[model samples]
Target: MRISDVLEKFDISSEREDYATIHDIVESGIVFKGTNLWILIFAILIASVGLNVNSTAVIIGAMLISPLMGPILGMGYSIATYDFPLLKKAFVNYLFAVVAGLLTSAAYFYITPIYQAHSELLARTQPTIYDVIIALVGGLAGIVAISSKLKGNVIPGVAIATALMPPLCTAGYGLATANWPFFFGALYLLTINTVFIGSATLFTVRLLRYPIRFLANESQKNMANRWVTFIVLLTTVPSIYYGYVLVQKENFTQNANNFIQNESFIEGDYLLKTELDANRKQIRLIYGGKTISEEEKTRLSQRKNIYGLAGVSIIVQQGFSVSEINKELSLSDRYQAEINRLKSELSHNIQQQDSVIKAQKLGGQLYKEIKPLFPEIDYCSASKQSFFVTSGATRNYTVVVLGSNQPVRTNRDLARITQWLKVRMKSDSLKIYIEKTAI
Candidate 1:
């Protein structure tokens, strides 16, 4: 077959909808008039519930169904076509939709039983460089898919990836809970999604050479251009800074984690809890059984440069043992006090909302997965300790502490278990602590 025929047979670019057609396609979705308004409102509720329940599937469905992307795409279209009227209309509608979304989510969360921000919610709080990249790429895909008659299959995936629905819900949760840091952080995330996605669409539309329909007067056009330039700078500069901060945090986290892996585990030293404060430029590691020595500390400090840490402070916070209920040994008041402090600090925000259900499922899964590997360890307790992953994932890890005196698993076994958890949990950060104790 001919090359053209071959390309056509593949149906690539053959099914593309034209410029005007694409305009109409997105334009039709611009209205929040009657049923569409209700759909958006309902979608907000669904998204909020999904976040509340920490259900990824439900949130994806909400993102797909929500019309939040319509106006964002329209704003991009207006810029691409230089239609001032369309831009104004789309902007107003977009603002209104945002308010509607935030309010709906806030109301739902206010009345709902769940108060804590789970993995789903926390994931949206800080927009990373990767999110910007995804939004940009997703926008391009969305525009291309829209420009193609083969739009149906690609659009939903774009919606899910773009995540147009979740940030607003997260912001709403923050608002309801009065967590200003979370609220503003989520808003910043939403802003990133909005700006980059719209920018990408505009880029795609210009690339496709979409004609300027109903062009503004020359004077008005100049004013519009200036305003657009200002808006672009306003939205983009902070995003660049935020992206930079995210990268720094990510690097700091890696170095801190490396330090913990190398230095935290000693003959008599084990980490009770470790806190990395990016704002304070410090890593506070709490150890149990024994405090880290000055010589060891000096060694860690020297390796700081090797680990990409130069100015960051490393504080070896003295910690008490986080031991299980040891029927073997009755502890004194001092030991009890230490344990209490350790428990309080380590367990801080350890359990989030809707974790009860998750714990049950994970418990079973951990046992099943671990049983085949080491059948000797009679008791295996797994709980998750999660913080923001700084960039991509939920930033969560499963902490599996095996309680047994005779561990058939060696250090190699422990390493293998960690790898298994990482692979199984899809989390790169897994902590496995072995407590040598008799039942």
Candidate 2:
């Protein structure tokens, strides 16, 4: 076959869904009627459960089934056709749907026993340039597929990729957990998806030459067109700016990943965790094994620009010493003696490490003041250890407090102090012990 013939056969626009049919599909998702309302609530519940349990499959299922995309497309149709009444209707319904999703998910998360931020949930909280691209593409694909005579799985797949449900659920989790950052980020992502999807639909409708919803005089038409242009322009400006920022972040993150891979040594230290704050232009790395030397630190610092983080600051934290744990295993026969020794040494070591971490976060001046507080307290510091009991019926997060030469306070006073520390540490499974400083 000729290349022209082959191209003609695959031309999507030739077989695009007629305006009437496309309108029907978009109209179905615009209203919050009985069935749509029920489905939305159900989808939100399913998404919330998926996020709670960190289940990717369940989340995808929720996304595919969600009615959230309906109002989004409806809004686009209204904008493209210059139907002010329809636009108002669709906008209201979309707001209601968002509120419903957020409320449903938030209610679910509030009572759940699990409060941990799992990977599946965390994924939705951060919106990047890639997410905007996915959202825009998904919106375009969805409208095109809806327009087609036969839509196999294109709409469903787009729904999954765009992930409208998960972000709402994530925002709910943040609200329930009182995590403002999570709430803001997830909500921001969700808003980005919604606005872009509507925008994409408008573009597609205009391209398809869809009939206008209402007839108007020439002056009225001009005014309507001006308003549409104004709205589109208003939306486009921020989206473009945020998109640019997201692209920069994605590039920086990609380069940082590459730099880390290049720096990894097979027999030496390995990366454990990385916290990249793109806005602050800071990279924090947690490494296991030996601490990085001054020379190696300089080498890493020098390579920041090579890794696309030209103005970024780098902080590295090494794992705490494991000699105590290793040596304690060998001296198990002298368990009692070593247990006391190990506890003291471990607590001191943790204190030093904590001091260093705090220093990096707060500053060197903060580290200097920590020593003076040592004389006022009866304990050097505290170390947290978790393990199962002999009965295996329970696990304990024991907080070993290394005692100093100062007076041992009353039990009530100590209890209050421990409670204060538990709040500061954000752990409810905490148990405190005030052991005297080992000789």
Candidate 3:
């Protein structure tokens, strides 16, 4: 009934599996050959497809079946037990699994017509502190499950949570597309997962006092500890920095949104569209209804600091006059008619309170109509954008931005989409922009 006795009742030592059994399980999972190699290939391909299509269910299914956890666990266990031969074997097999996974997924991505980077794929590219924590915790859970008397669904859940397969597939995607940023980012994430998971296993093994397979002198032990420490530090510091960057981005976005919402109305003009680029620390504000003066623009830009955006650059663009348009479009009669019609429509839309609503409705219709024709496009949005022209003039154009899961391979494909949007939307002066979303 004492506190110490009560705590003793919750001890995991009583439920621990034999050391020999745990060792056998870890060792058996290390080799990448025959069934294991085939399974890994299939899993990587499935994950790649899932990422290409942006299917969460499919990605989870792939993770459940991945054999990547085996070699990682083997490395950790071998290192903890001072079994150099087993460590060497595990390291070799781990390399084989990584190479196999990368090659298989890369081949699949290369052949697939839809090779856009989706949200799911992008999610893996940036490894943050949260990912590191998940991998470490997942590893601890996995080792515990394997060494426990009652093993259930923990291993599969750990595999899914840790997400060993997707990052590898994403890296392969980068390889296929020759996108070095995507490749390095995803590879960095995979490395973080691997190192932290192995580190976690090592920690748990030491805690459980797993018997060492070989004896080592003081110098050897010190050398091994130093190497492990170095590896852990190398993997962890970057993730911490990435996590900080992620936080800064989120804060910037939130602050930018606040600034836009609060300062959208400048004198008589109204905000038509706002484009925020967190990477460049730039905020582009497009206004309509009335032209804003230099004084008004300066006032608006100065307000960014109130919303915690001190260093952010603000570019303000306002609606242009019909004479400005006439001067810019010194072309055929057809082009003149198109510009005149666009001007009329812009005037009417600017007067209406539901211009945003109309834009949203048009976007939905565009998406519905375009989805079947362009299966690569994941989303589509139609908006009236005030473009800052090279002639120091701003012109309003109906911009249809298509978020494609794959890259728009050629100018012809973009032209086709642009033509289709013009006809469907009944606007001759419409512009088309394709933004890569996923792969």
Candidate 4:
């Protein structure tokens, strides 16, 4: 349908009289207060630990336990039905939850052994149009769940989409780390999520015609409606502005990614940092590489969305190279060929060396038929009267033939030396070869 038709469908003018009052809606959520509060606390604590340890599973578990969705939805219903008293209650409760969640997570982070921030925490610090879209869609779904006569298992699904706890924990981590930008960015993300979800819920409630049964004075009802409009505007303006900011961030990420894809650049050799602040209208792209040229800048500027983003600063610095890009590509075709040649040469040399050594040890004709009992000796010095044999992978052998002129006296002595060598080698790949050298 057209935009006009869609708007009309959700508009208050199109709403039915069976609408439930904000008071009743708020009352329903209160029943879960103890359960919600405990869950909120648990989720925040788990999220805080997840941020500290960088565990995604822990953070998700915390998200499941968090009871934050209720108050946010409460705020939406209060506004939709023009119930000022209910609205006030929701606003206060929501504020309390946000503060409690943040403080609890921060306190936990302060005491946790893991000081390093995880990817999950960093992910929360960036708000984009995509986040607004998620909140909007989730809000509609949450409102639908509340209004439906058939209450299905929507809580698990709603909890994942609304994502109330992770951002709070992320903000807490930022506070603990004393990172001002991280704290502010994460707070903005949380704010965007709340406003969009609440507003979307209001829109859905108006569309679905959920009953407003509580009677009120005409004057009070009018005043409440006016107040709701004002509050909705208050939430909407900031969200629209932040959506613009998200656009700028998208541009920066796209440009940075494009720069790295150039044939002259090695993909994994450099790290890119793209920071775009829409309020400041400043975009900064820092990359580890030799100086980028005017051509590269022009290529980035070619992006239509990026062109609108002003104050763009690009910094490229020198970094180590694993291999030059052009040379690496050129050699790739011959890589397997080179490897095979090296392997064959190595195998042939090993066979020839063993044959010569065996013949020389044989001496006149069958090498005096003396079994070379200890082939693998670490160090041997006949003059010093010291023979040190180390353990090989297969067996350990120590040959302490006291008189260097003769091989180890007994088969048992030779076997003991082999065993010793094997234990010393500590390698599963090695085999024991006993060789006796004349003193």
Top model number, TM-score: 3
How close to the true structure is residue 375 of candidate 1, measured as C-alpha lDDT? 63
Q: Cα miss at 376, model 4 (Å)?
A: 84
User: Clashing residue pairs, candidate 2?
Assistant: 17-147, 378-404
Model 4, range 1-439, lDDT digits (tens) per residue? 8999888876543232333443455555643357677777888898888877888788778777777877778878766766556767778888888888878888888888788766887888766667778888988877776665444777667778777788888888788878878888888878777877788888877676656544667887778667656765664566577668767666766654444333223223233333445355444444344555666656555442444434554444334232442243346433542443344355556767887675444233211222354433323311112234565333333222222334556888766755654454343333334345544
lDDT of 1 at 68: 87
User: Could you give the C-alpha RMSD of every candidate to the true structure, in order shown?
Assistant: 18.2, 22.2, 21.9, 22.0
Candidate 3, 136-213: lDDT as tens digits: 999999998998988899999999999999999999999999998999999999998899889889899999999999
User: What TM-score does candidate 3 get on C-alpha atoms?
Assistant: 0.72
Candidate 4 has its poorest 10 consecutive residues by lDDT at 378-387
- For residue 129, give model 1's deviation from the true position in Å: 3.4
Give the TM-score (vs. native) of candidate 2. Answer: 0.62
How close is every model to the real structure, measured as TM-score?
0.66, 0.62, 0.72, 0.54
Clashes of each: 0, 2, 9, 33
lDDT of 2: 0.75
Once fitted onto the true fold, the runs of candidate 3 whose alpha carbons sit more than 4 angstroms away are 321-439
Model 4 spans with C-alpha error above 4 angstroms: 1-26, 31-33, 214-439
Error of 2 at 31 (Å): 1.3
Residue lDDT tens for model 1, 1-439? 7899777785545576876778788888777878889999999999999999999999988988988888999998888788767888888999999999999999999999878789999988877667878888998888888888767788888889989889999999989989998899889878878887888888877787778887567887788667766876776677778789988888889987776655444445545556789778898766656556788778767777777778989887653553632332345633654554455444432443447768767756777778778766656677777766657566666777776667645678777767877788787667777777856
Q: Which of 1 and 2 is ahead in TM-score?
A: 1
